[model samples]
Target: MDATIAALEELTPVSSSFAPIDDSAYIRFARTSPGTRTPVLIFNAIGVSSELFLPLSLSLVAAGHSVVLWEYGRVGDDGDTFFSRVQSYKALLGHLRAGLYDLGLEDCHAVTLCNGASVLARLQAELPFAVSRAALISPYFNLLHVPHQSPYETALVPLLMKAATDEGGAARFVHSVLNRGGHAVASKEALSKAHMASPRSIAGYSRMLRDYRRHDETDVLRRVKGELHAFYCLDDEAVSTDYLEAIRSAKPSIGLSTYAGGGHYGIVDNPSLLADVTAYLGGDR
Candidate 1:
């Protein structure tokens, strides 16, 4: 356990980076190894933050793949996200797309859990950079139950939407609700006091939830250029397992795996699921 904690602390001494992706977005690159081996890019889950990817990131980087972990200004604040710089989600996406193109990271394998899956799927396909392989873990693609949301979402999101008018206050409230009841502690208080006190640039993260659910699954899949792998944790509360059928129907050829256990962020604690995901992203599969 000591060794594991040491590894996590060592890989990303800082949970997030201050270097702005744009006026509002930021990335938490745990480790960067530029090499001939294909690189890996992990997308950020909404409230979970990119910090949760540390265990997975540590494994991937140790396997010799350059790994970049990123998160945008979403409706939640785990102390890692900068709500102050948030523009609309569309603007942040544009910033990331531009940055990826500038760095020539066009062929990287991409992995995302929850709402991050939506954004990764939305990246413009016309760009020279094409995602080689994508692994969607407990994906929260909202297109499922198209006529309505799953039970969990129905109970919680409306309240959040109503509260988004107060940016900073809403961020904390949303964060508290999405903290998985503290089931996942990797997103511990890692933000600096100064960073926390930084002035916010946005009026509020009012459009975030709407932005995630607006993408078309089929269209997003059409844009991806490689094999797609999805991990469905049957117990995930933020996103239900029912979405699997919707995703499967959208892309019948896409690979699928299911686990009856594990929370929304449970992949970190469930070593089997962790290894399975690592093999897929690390190309051992």
Candidate 2:
């Protein structure tokens, strides 16, 4: 366990340069191998910061792929930024594109999870650089069609914020949401990492949730020129089989894989999933 932690910590250190794209946005991303042309760009799940992606980033690096981890500014804090979904997406996407250029990365492969996939699917036609391949893990492309949550969930926002502020509440909440809740220490650690995101950004995520729309899947898929690899987890609560079927119908050419038991967060640490991603990035797909 100590060795694993050490390895993840060593993936990208603070000594690496973090470039700022604008006053409201910055990206702390670095390429593991400068000469390696095919970079793996990670589109982290919304509401969760880039820090939580360290383990997966480290694993990808170990498998001989350059990785890019990124996040954007918080909303409602900047008058220049509005509380719109497109505004949020533009911010994150802009920062990442600028950061990649600054880091001398192009012709990359992208790996996205959950809402990140949704954003990527919508912006597939607008990417600044060429993409060789793209992988979607438990992609929740149809956010509007997902099973509805309790209406009371919004009312409990204050309580949820309170829970996130305390260690025990945060742990319980993380454990409950994650597929691998049995790992208590990991759950707590994840909670700690999530706190790295600013409150304004978190609030913006809530706003995004309230205002999300279902994009035209067929049209979006038609715009994507790169090879697509999609993974669906058997135990993911956030994404359903219907979602997968919808995507399959829209983009039949996409390479699809399913895991028996990796909830949304499980794939982040699953060795087989990491290996598959590495293979795809390495053009073995």
State the C-alpha lDDT per candidate. 0.59, 0.56
In model 1, the runs with Cα more than 4 Å from the true position are: 1-31, 73-81, 124-126, 144-151, 166-203, 214-218
After superposition on all CA atoms, what RMSD does each candidate show versus the true structure?
Answer: 5.2, 6.6
- Superposed by TM-score, candidate 2 places the C-alpha of residue 98 at a distance from the truth, in angstroms, of 3.5
Best by lDDT: 1
Cα miss at 100, model 1 (Å)? 1.6
Query: lDDT per residue, candidate 1, 1-99, as tens digits?
Result: 123234655643423233355554564334364644677887766434455666787777667667765544432443334444543567667766765
Cα TM-score per model: 0.75, 0.69
Cα lDDT tens digits, model 2, 156-254, are: 433344443343554345334432445422234543344223343334444444344424345655566678888766666555666666766677877
Worst 10 residues of 2 by lDDT: 75-84
Which has the greatest TM-score? 1
Q: Which regions of candidate 2 fall more than 4 Å away from where they truly are?
A: 1-25, 35-37, 73-87, 143-188, 195-201, 214-218
